[model samples]
Target: MNPFELEAAVKAAADGDASAFAQLIEAERTQMLRVAGYYVRNHIDAEDAVQEAICRAFTALPTLREPKYFRTWLTRIVINTSMSLLERSRKTIPTGGAEAEYLTASHKDTDGTLDLLQAVSALPPKVRRVILLKYMHDLRLKDIAELLELPLGTVKTYQNKGLNLLRTYYREEIEERRRAVEPIAADSAAWEGKDMESELSEMLHRSRERAKTLFENQSAVASAELKPFIEDVFRHGDQVRELLFIWTKPGTEIGISVTLSPDGDLIDYSVDMELYTEQEKCLHLPPEELFAIGERFVRDHYPDAPDQFSALEIEDRGDRVFFSCSQYASGMPLPRSGFWIDLHRSGFVTAFKYFGSKPEPVMPDHILTPEELLEEVAKDLSMKLYFMRLHESVHSQGDDRLHLVYMPQPYLINRPAVPESGESKKNAQAKDDYDPCAGANEPILEVLRRNEPGVPADPETLLESLGISEAEYEVLREVDMGSERGVVYRRREAVPAAEAVDSTDPYTLYRYMQARNEETVKVRFDRDSGRISSFIDFREETGILQLDDRACLEIALNLLHTADPFVFPHLRLNLEEEEDKETEQPSRQNAGFNFSVCKDSVPGFSHHVSVSVNRTTGRINHYMSADLGMEELEKLSLVPSLPLEEAKRRLIAALEPRLIWELDYSDDRSGDGHYMLRYKLVERESGLSVRMIEAHTGQIVTDNF
Candidate 1:
């Protein structure tokens, strides 16, 4: 069938038309049977597998995300069905005359191809599947990984191992039979037909032309002084896309990226110091010298920049140091209006970012003192339990796990409450309830305790919750959602992208994926730590299931319990019915329940599991868990060393506000906005210059952004 006809048939099939599904399957029957034969070997079993796969596909047709990829999706289902059938029967009968027609249909009826197939069948099951998918189906390694639900690295390993075994088993005969088909070496004479150097030169020329064209389109706003710097940076860049120019060394990760505004103004410039590669290494220069270098750069590039921008603070990060300067007006630094230079130990200026076009505003004559500021900000200061995810560190031996700890927040000063209206109520509520702290902390593992690890959910139980029977639907596609530091485990329904899977629900990921292609349930966990980090159910309803809110909640709760029983007791349903009533936007049609983790009924941390249930089938179409593991929770420092009153006292004592000029962009119609004088909280420890306070020994742990 042609592409348009096939798509129409897929659409018709998705709408419960069995005839269209039959036509779709019939057109690809020969190819389907051949793929099935790779796993089952015998003709009878292959045909049975194909028939069973067709039945399953017909039943699950509506769940398909992309109609155009119908054939590829059907082939995947056949492969899975065949493997499942083989596993159940444990039969390894050699291929006979009955299967020769199906097996040799595309192999040109060659004995070498038959020999190769037999050799592959003799190999290990996983390796054999990899080889068949890579060569027979002509799929990329990544595609094979997604098809088999294995890691791309693991799939590549299996492919290489299978090829080595094949060479060892049939190297001599294959070489003699197909000498001309051998892979050509880099220096082979076969490449002499093409001018490689000229081709590369032409490609380079085209890339430059594209870059020039892009630059010219926005040349009206381009500053004359910025031309030299832009040319120097773009000269080393390999790619110029839109306003972003990126250049990375071929073999090394050392690179730099520059982003510009639509009007050709600089937005951001950063260096990717991948473990401080030789080219990007810093000289470890003194702070004084680094500060001088920053000032000199500003003096040369920005006229009067050295006079307008004053040094605020310096942060020493062992390998590199950051010298931050802010646009000063009336001897006070403006909040969120500053540029920081990253200088390496090698004395190299690794990064230079200019936050420019200083706003002219009337300076505030009077600023609130620490005593008066304490009274105003004291009400907003409070100690709350926080779930902080640690960063992967070698010195501290951190494993990037979540840890529950006490943290202090100047809520009013740091983040003022905003009025929510219309469709923003749900998003506003989510932000208020689950604003994660920015940056990771290096946890001292030796001082912290560890809890007994809980068992992960059984693959069978997870399937059962979705109304999928283990006996009836035996194909378990294991998806390797890559989590390097944790165990990766996934089991989901085998449905490809179908166009009819669109969703209008804001809470559902169907809308996030844009519903243009691919939809499937994916459960991913850290590979080494074996902790569940994410679980998303994107499968569309099959019209065979339906339930109410209680039933949906029960299903979600049951699944959460199966995943981690200990965490189950601490979870409470986060019903936002009242919040939804205030919004003028369309009410949510799907049933979604967010369960927040609480200790003794106090909701402090932002660890929750959100489940989206389809209103039509009552089956969970989306499930996301950002909760910490029970073992990680056991390591939490529940009790604070300082009393709440004492913590508040310290917070009050540390409170100080500086008067500065800030641009007001509440209703920014034009690019230029009027500036206003504002009072911003500053840290007294940094001489009332910086905005961050040093963490107390056992009081305020960290600031939540």
Candidate 2:
């Protein structure tokens, strides 16, 4: 929507027009939900938060000081609501009505994914929120910090600490499995009691029982450091019970570990594949069936599997074909194999390899995961399974590097209460000075026995309770409407401008800014030929003000300021999808805009289309080309024959960032050699139309016009 449409919508909503408000809501709901979902992992809960946030915004619209910031304001509400819901089930906002209204398809998917979400939901509020924002919602850390009103450093600290714990936990699990295998061969005499097949069966039974017991008695057996990861990791272990217990044929646990960047990149990860058996197990898979099962498993579970992970090497070693599946992805905590019809065996899984950036410099394991070492040193800090680690550049922080740990509250709505005796004493602690309602008639405190229970009643309530009829209340409310009557304006007349300026009146004095000299050039809109623009203007012939540009700007700003914020907010966004094996990052080309005002009239949204000094940029950019109007060629340049590119070149000037230059020939040069300059080029590229911008003036220096 353009500024005028936005202004109109805001004005209508401010006047209680709910339909106008809907457009604003529709435009922002997706962004609100995305941010809200991160806070409230529970789909239904997030939906509830958005609804309530919108509803609250509707009523609060009247109080907004800046409507242009509606987007950010609503986001703040959504973020706060998510945190409130996560930390305490008791909602921060009354959203009961909104929850039912905003339900969508995603809200229903929450049920089946509960098994997977177990680990995620177990995280503390702060940690879990960070993870949700980073992965689930794919928000940048900088935005997360701004939305949550937190310092950037603090958010980064939480992210690093959280992911480190998760990585260490998975790594430790692998180490334990390795130790259980004990690389040294088992004693031959240990199988003295029975034949190899029968002995293997007995060992399988024991191993299954042990694994089941660990799964069942984990609440007690798991160490505190790994307990949170364990609970969520296996929270829905029962949901996948058959797969975990019944289809049991494990060598080593298949686990995955993910490393995330502050910018939402899946920077690194490892998938570990292990082959081991309990104290004993049967290797009786006829070579034919085993290979079939392994191949089927890889194909079914990893349909999006990496291409050519490893060359399959099959060698017929007389007794059996050694099928070697090599160099699979390591550090994946999630198992790779799922049930495949061809595999016939649900438990059969094959090793896979990892892709993406090679890990940074061959730092020692401890360097990569210093938080683990810290845990080893400080036994008490165990909350570290929900964050991504990103190194801080020295320019950002003075530290060598910082970790972002997601620290969410593990539970919600459990708070300590005050004692009964202290409750009575609360009234005694009430503030003393400036009680406008002090001993006022009607004792109106009873109406708000909730918000301000022990406090004095408000004056409005006091008057209403004093038998002031509805008719009488309006007069009282309007008594001091125009301005505070306690001062000279008490006579109920418009004060003259002289007194308005001299007086520290209830309203701020108006200061008219000097009007800039009239400047004009032809401007054109390719599509919306009839839309009015928001700009300052002056009549060329009369040399008189055609319109007060400042007043026009103030009107738009005021409408934004007064309009319901939940319905509209200022929003600026930059988002791009990640590069994966199948796809690469695409370069974005930015095309510059050109405009010169025309005498021709244009249609508008609600008002007249006038070509003025408006400088608003276009909405989303689309690739296209257009012929420059003859007038555009002239207004921007008196050289009629000169092409657009050459004309632009003469208009541009170059400059460097943060650099100061002192010309020896300058008569007005200061003693200090300093004048900072910044640069930008106007013409943009969209992979085809190449152009260079004049660094200093941000004008189109050159382009393939």
Candidate 3:
């Protein structure tokens, strides 16, 4: 629908026109499902969330301030509803049995589809939500921020972090598969005492010979209308023991290579064919001219080539040029489907090889509208949340409190509790005095109550008095209290005074207060809600032992295990960097050890754990770790709700054609402009949006344009 039509419909819907409301809902249904699926694991739940959102939107339509923002408004409602459902059902949702059965019945597996599904499924909910909205729905980063009510920076972080996680996981999986097959392959006679290069050469030779015969027998050029004959014997090499033969006709040429082993046995061979050539050598051809040459070559040789081959790229190799082009459908490049044309310095086409099969036109027996396809897509959507540790620099004396913003996309309600009115000033003035021998057995709240006025009732008692459910809050107890000496407590406003706190505030501070012998405690509780946010304990040691990198790593790993028991097996020490320069006295220096979570010890995963230790003292100074909270993810099913092929078809069906101005730079330094036709899938009313869908996984691919 055009912008005017959509705006009119939205206006009518807001005016209490039921049919118009339905029309708006129907138009945006598929998009809504794509967004909702990012929060919920199954289509059933996604549908439930979207259904609830629709009901809520209809009831609140009259309050919509802008008709043009109808899609964004409805999307926000869906996100909220989906998150609410996920939060409520996180603990009790059953795993893969019934869902697996349904998936098995509805979907047939395709290449890389299952792996892509698993990788995405394992991402954290917030990261997954960003991935879906940005890639699956083709929403711009800014649009995603607006939809999820997040900062644009945060959305970008999620995208990068999520993709890094996916890449790491995929690499690990590939390594595992390679490891699994290595033992068997190593024991085979064909591999025993043979170099890999030699084995590959032999295999390629056999494959190429077969390919040559097949081409000669069945290729279009082999027909009687075009009789080609051997024209030349290219340079034969003795070092490689390879022979090259060239065949030519009026408008076509073919080259073949045959390699032999030391024993004169066949090793490998390759065939290259060309349909166009230029006899004159042009030392420097403009990029436009190069592009024109490629275009003309393809049109003359392969006139029936599909529309997917429109995207092109030209690489200048100084001695020659290589043109690599791919076919695109629905704003995405088709996998492995295109041609590679090599142009020599003489401007003659040297080779043309169709690297992938021609894509069959997708013509579904019945075409589903966007609304109908939304139902199908809902069945395939999955949601997951990952935990990422973002570093924020602060003065050592600034507030140590971790302030979390509640993002609806990930469905985390981490709002800082607002201090009660009229009490902010009093709370701000309260000071915490550090006593190494302060009350050990009493609750910290009780200690606070004894030390200060205006301390509300005991936290548990206050919650009980307020009739709040204990289960609503998850108390993270025994967090670390970093090593910092001095007055541990400071009375400050429990609420943050601004969106961002000034670093130089006199009262802003982070310190350690003794809770018991050899121990310190830092407690964070919502002053307004009377619920605990986190409680961390630090143990103080009197003696320091000399240690090395290995010992430090062992201690760091132990601490990591204590912090998160599940990550121990997957964690591997990735890097150990020295933080201080060597001295003549050989005194110990601080060192940082970084650990990454790998599936089977394969590297390249993001660093999840960082431990800082006093290398001379053998004491761990500080450490931090992040994960996708996989324990929660493990409880949910990994089975997709929809089939891969069906999802692709549905995505394609929902795509809307758009005109885009593509630029072709001139090869000469003149900087002349050339325009070409290109198609993009864009969100309605968005500014020059170009949406790309991954052909294999049916996910959107975001690009810088």
Candidate 4:
């Protein structure tokens, strides 16, 4: 119905018109059922909740303060009815009233299904109430504050805490499932002759048992000073969890919240912003008055803030003025541990954020002077040429084609590597074999050992090598890649019939068990040629380590030669010295190798093959190689028009040194991090930070507007 008709119907319904009330409520029945389903979870219970809400709304229709809010009023009644029904079904007797038990008497859940409602119901009572009102019922923060008779800040704080708890719960559930499946896959001997369905059912049964006392196990840890603020907030989980203490006047969004660590030490304290009201936030107060208000709030909360912190700068953001403060050590600022207080123009502190921890930084023995920093930046910075396609918006006067351009380097200064003397810095760079342009030479194309086409190999033999049985596996064909075809073999298992049952009783049924993937071996090949392109083993590996980098490379090379013997001589191991210097060594768990087939070593015209092996089994876990035809690579340009020396000169001429403070987070064995003042290079005049440099013309361009 249109707004006018709805308004008229609401008026008539409120004036004791039964027909109008029926018509109005009938129009909203579908929406009411959906909202009810969010709480009650099943269709039957949802319909029952909606019916009960219709009766309650009809009795209280005349009491609604505004006729325009008829839908909202009815929705609130539906939410309450659904919660009441859900509570009764869960065998939890709610306070305030006793009503006719419908589902409680007849419904008996045989399977536990932990849906979204079950997760929310597992939360602390106060937090659960706020989450239901805010999300399930779609109530505004302002409306919720008024209905609950609690501060707006408190509701918002509860909302954030509820979200964090839900995220942690879901993450734990995923990890638990992964742990459950890995044992079944890795230990075949122990699980021999066992039914997979029975094992999964037992795991789910334990999870459901834990869900019964999930809320009671978790307890929030807070200081005595913070206890008064968090008395209404609910706590969950076995370990002490983070608690947020917030206080605000009813109806106003302006309030304060303090976050405390598990040890009751201060993590952060901040004032909540007052955003909903249309009134001007500025009081036209002078800078002195604003500073005083902020200082007072900081001092009252933290008595030692004046002695330990120093005011950094003042920012006037029109609505609120902010006073930035930071901890100082060795006459330099510690950026991480600090507080920022913002005030409304009326000289009242609108927001305050403080960090109380003190960090002990490993102080630099010798600081770099401005001249030394600039000299180091000039020596380290160099231009690298790239071919980039600019967006049409960025190239208003030019066509959208690839352009070559030179961009400056050294955006980040590795503070720990900065030397105390220029001689030491030069020696260190030489010893480490540092190359500024090392990142530009990454392999663009991967090619397999076979360049010549041959007869397709038997898939049965490959499956036997991976310890997979053809009798228990079935092939899945997909044509999503257009020209390329994909074939996946999934292991078959019997699905439990009882698992499909959705039971709403929280105390009786097993919580919802999300679908789990049993490890399936997959192999993909060219459809026409029948030559295998990629193979992956999805099963978990658990055994003694055997293969290292050299062993893995030997296995990869032999596999490539077996696939295509003719092109095996042309493929070269593509590991570069620059790669070793820049990248960390691969872990022992999985060793990877790459081999490339280049056309006269031309950029973007070469193909590479990458193979990764499981160290424990000494078998290839993943094998991937590009299948680009040789005819395609022969069409691209092989050489560049610009010389290397000219590009270098242009890059050096455009470079300008910029000094900055850098933080070093690496542990230097002394258990303290370090900070250094250094210089980096940027574009000279306009300072446009575009990375794309036109190769032939030596001009800078951007891919973004």
Candidate 5:
């Protein structure tokens, strides 16, 4: 299927279309099993591992943010699942295989492909993963890094090691066969028929089912594969178990630490739960200190108490603190007006927040002096940040920082909890019994012989071969329903561009928003420097805009169907017009970019936002909430860990009279940003919002007109 169809199928699966998902999975299971068997040497274990991975992938289906990475994501999950299975295994499996059509026409040629497959199947699990990825898929080092979430250097290392092992193994195997048939060696010309590369490729592409079938039929199957499964599954399980525990249990082992400025002042503090391992050994703060420390910490140490103070989950170890804040929820949106703090163990803090100004009905129990906030979270940040800096020292220069992140095995400090006593003894007994991860120094050739498949294509060529339908492709176009067209068509040379003036509401409240409506929001943001320099968009609209005594709420959704929003060769947007809305001028101009904007208003609360557009995708790349001051921030104790919907509800309660406008400036390089219009609704009050346009273009530097 083409990308669009795949995306739609993914979306359907996310929405609970079990059948569609099953079909997609069934179509790819053959490949999935091959890959799984390569990473996991035991055929039975490999089968079990792939099934488990598929189930997890299906359950967490919605978490997939990008459809294009589907295969890669699935590959990672399968690898992870196999590793997990290995960890939990007590005894390792001994061998594996992939299917081959043993029939050759006229029985004339003994398939060389089988020989090639045998060599690959012989390599170690780790080395095999690299080989299959490199040869079977022919992906570059960097792409493999993204797929596996491993470093490019590490991938390269595996590639080199695996190839060298294969070369050494293939030579030894050839010699053994030659010794038995000395005539072939004497007539070396006849033996030139053994093609090592072809055989290896076939092995990498071998079917897992075939490998399994071979193992079941064999008299003695090795047990090494099971050992790896035991090792990996338990290791993986432990990490997952810890995260869930931290998320569900409160104050199980809370601890915090702080780094004092030589001047003994606070710079930044973070709240984390991975610090203190033993709650019993953790520092226990005397009650009196909690109340008393408030004065000096906020009033004297951070005179900017109301401003610079930060409060988060802090491991309250009497003197040696640990980390975290009850970010589960904020009570209110504190006006950027006053200072508020809280003092409590995790459960209290997690259920409610205060740094973003939460409720402090009872000062002693809930609220703390500004000083208390600083004392709590700084310790946690210091520890986590210190480790981060150390890692940075090692890999900081590897790549550009503007769009990529380089984090090594996210800061792991809390020692993994020992499995309960009984399970530990049981696992020990199991460990003494099996050896599955290693199937011997299995000749790379024999392993490959078991799994190799028939037809093969290069990475790019294969995707083309799957080919999706054109009709489905059309539904994938990028759309912008927010065009301020009245000014363009009615007032310009051709037709009326704007929808009939929003009789109910129109206009933007933020002064900066005028830039979106006027097509003059010049934005210059440098990723490396982290700066928003300028943004602009201008449009002339001829319609009655009745916006007063009200606020507006508008949302514009740009449906994207292509990887390159511009020059999208396969798709186009379809817009349905409403009779109630004003007649619009149909033109070749805004046909590609379709926009949708909605507006409404409320009473007493003041809020407004404006967005800009600069590319064919015409999507709002970022949004700066209009009134995100400390007062409101402090009340956002509910913001930290809430689902997006819960966060929105809390925001609505806290920031009532607010306006947020968003526009898409996908590419400044193409002044084509000009023809794109993002729609919007400006609200002045609780129930008041004006429908309008925030067309932004011509603010970017592009090589072409």
Candidate 6:
């Protein structure tokens, strides 16, 4: 079986073609058994492991991303199965017979060969496996590293350690054998001048040379033997126009490169038993002609190249033309995934390197309409106001103004409710009865009563006492609301009193009291700097009052209109029952509505804002906002390119179902040990992924792109 044929067989097997799968197993049975034998005690155990591996391979064939690597993939499965069996049985497998059959036949001194094999087998499993693969299987260090999924340097260490152990064991065994045949004095005299280390090294070197020679012979035979197989596999046969060379290395693909002469004649050809790089042949050709030649070369050699490869760049360095191309899907180029073909002036391909696997686009069976997708987005739509700083130039100085922007709400995935323990439930009930607003009302009333007859105070002294630096604060204006009189200062040098009060510090206890004609002690702090720049104290009493949820929501909506008209249309009330559970009580709770933007029904790409109104006074309690800069707002596409129905269709077509372990955020108890099935939406070309819809509900679960 050749590489191409093996890949075809793997594909066929993956598609449930039993005959092709059988052929694949038959071709690899010998190698699989040989590798498996190292880990088990006997032929029966080795055979069992190989059989189990074959079953597993057949079952997992569809998951194999690259069919060209069927051999390595199967070999790994065998190794794993064998290791598992070894661990389960907890028995050491002696290598006497297996070693004699595999390694000792090449050596003339059977005793010495057996001693070396014993030493190798005596080493730890990892080291022993490396030695056997390198020497017995005639695999290179690089091949061993890949086969074991270890780093090259780590494999070299194991090889050296194994060799040192073998040398020690061989020397001890040789000394014991010599002593049995001769007297101690005679044996010492006979071995006195001999360097055992040198002898051992020479012996090991000879064994390695034999293995190399055997590999070379095998390679020579494979070149001739595999020619017909390659021709048949490539579907060219004897009429092949280009010279084909099969490059093979231990634990790697038997890659074939086709070389064409300038005049389209068959050039020199040779098969390499290891990875080989050919010297560059300079070709004098125009950039356009070179690009055409490179494209043709790739098409002829790798018929498996992706369908859409855009020209990334064409570098003309006088001597050569390097044309780079990348794979793209839906106009988006895959990151670091493409081929770079370098050509010299002589029309020779200097290098052909591919960075990523070929793209496999899967069209979903059911296409969703844009409207359907929009509906899904609406379910998770959250509205939030973001405070953004807008800068304007007033003469030479820059004036920073705060603005509120409306955007889509982010992840609104339904979290599982946590089951509370008995003690926790009791504590939560107790907390529910604790009225935070009532407690806050008492302090404001006391401050109002004490300062009802507004006393005059120096603004600078007042700011200093409030832990604010004069350099960062400046008195902006003075206001008299009947009983209360106070000066308002800039929250920060950049922010105005009106903007700060309107945006972040809307529901301060003092501000609430001011509206009621109660004690007018008011203070506003810069949200970011923690500096108080606005203070007012009034002597009066404002009785407790409450507002309904409808009134609160109306106030919030009205505020949005005043903040930014552009943001009003995009905002939608998030009326989720579970989300509003905390504010359900009419008397104790301030009515508030969570608003989210459903502007464009794209999952994982939205913004949000929330507003809460005081239950008693119907005053705005909290207004959450985001700072979406002007540049970002300018780029906002109010209308989506695709309709909700169309987006849904594309999503359905591109959905990939898989079992994933996702954190159940809703789970109140620990919230850590839950996983479920999910269908993921992945862009094939770029590998950009998002978990848009759940498998069960077909609803958007995440807004992450």
Which model, 4 or 5, shows the larger lDDT?
A: 4
1-705 in candidate 2: lDDT tens per residue? 322344455544543444456656655655565556544554445555775567556644433433543554566566555554443332111222212111221222233345435655655567667656654654545445644555443465455434433333334443443354343213311232135335334543454444444333323212212211100001111111111121112221233222222222222222222222321123445656767655653454355332334444454433233333322233211111111111112223222222222222221232213233222212211111111111121111112111222121111101112121353333222221211111111211222232222322332342233222344322211112111111011112323232434432111000110011112111111232221111111112222233333333332222222221111111111111121111211111111111111111111011111111222321111111111122232232211243434433332222111111111111211111211111121222321111222222223322111
Better of 1 and 2 by TM-score: 1
**Could you give the candidate ranking by lDDT, starting with the highest?**
4, 1, 6, 3, 2, 5
Please, what are the lDDT tens digits per residue for candidate 1 over residues 16-129? 333355557656665566566655655545655876677557644544555755764686677657655653343322132112111212121145445767888877778888
Clashes of each: 19, 62, 17, 23, 185, 53
Worst window of 10 by summed lDDT in candidate 4: 507-516
| C-alpha lDDT score of every prediction, in listed order | 0.48, 0.30, 0.41, 0.48, 0.29, 0.42
Candidate 4 Cα outliers beyond 4 Å, as residue runs: 1-260, 265-335, 339-372, 377-419, 431-538, 542-572, 575-591, 595-609, 615-619, 623-638, 666-672, 684-694, 697-705
Candidate 6: worst-modelled 10 consecutive residues by lDDT: 228-237
Could you give candidate 3's per-residue lDDT for residues 531-650 as a string of tens digits?
332222232233455666556655655455444455544455442112111111112344455555533222211224556565565655544443224353344333344455564454
lDDT of 2: 0.30
Per-residue alpha-carbon lDDT of model 4 for 1-705, expressed as tens digits? 433346566755554444457658656765576556545655545655776678557644544544644664575567667665664345221221111111221112212234567878877766777778766664545445545655444565465456556544555454454455444432432233134234333533443333212211212111112211221111111122233344344433234454444344444444333422334443488888778777776776577785677755787666667677776766666644577766667665544556555655555566666456555645665544333333343332235343444443422222232455565444323211222222222222122423343433455565555555677776643433323355556566633232344542221111111111125455655566666666765455566766666676666665665554444444555453332323223334566665645444332211346677777777777765445444444543435456656765665566555544444322222212345554444466655323334556656442121
In model 2, the Cα lDDT at residue 148 comes to: 59
Q: For candidate 4, what is the TM-score?
A: 0.38
lDDT of 6 by residue, 1-705 (tens): 434446566765654444456658756765565566645534444655776677557645654656755665686677667655553333322222111111111111235544556666677777788778765654545445545655444565565455545545555555555445343433333343235324433543443343233234433333433221111000011111222223334333343332332223222222322232232232366777877777886665455553446755776666556666665543444433466666666565545555444443333345444344434444444333233222221101112433233322332222112333465434222211111111112322333344333322344444454334567655554443222233444434353222334432122211221233222223433334233222332221232776666666656665554343454444555442242233244543345454544334321122445555666655554444322323455554433333445445544454332222222212212211223222233333433333333222233222111
Task: List per-candidate RMSD values in Å.
Answer: 23.9, 34.1, 27.7, 24.0, 30.9, 29.4
TM-score of each: 0.46, 0.19, 0.23, 0.38, 0.17, 0.23
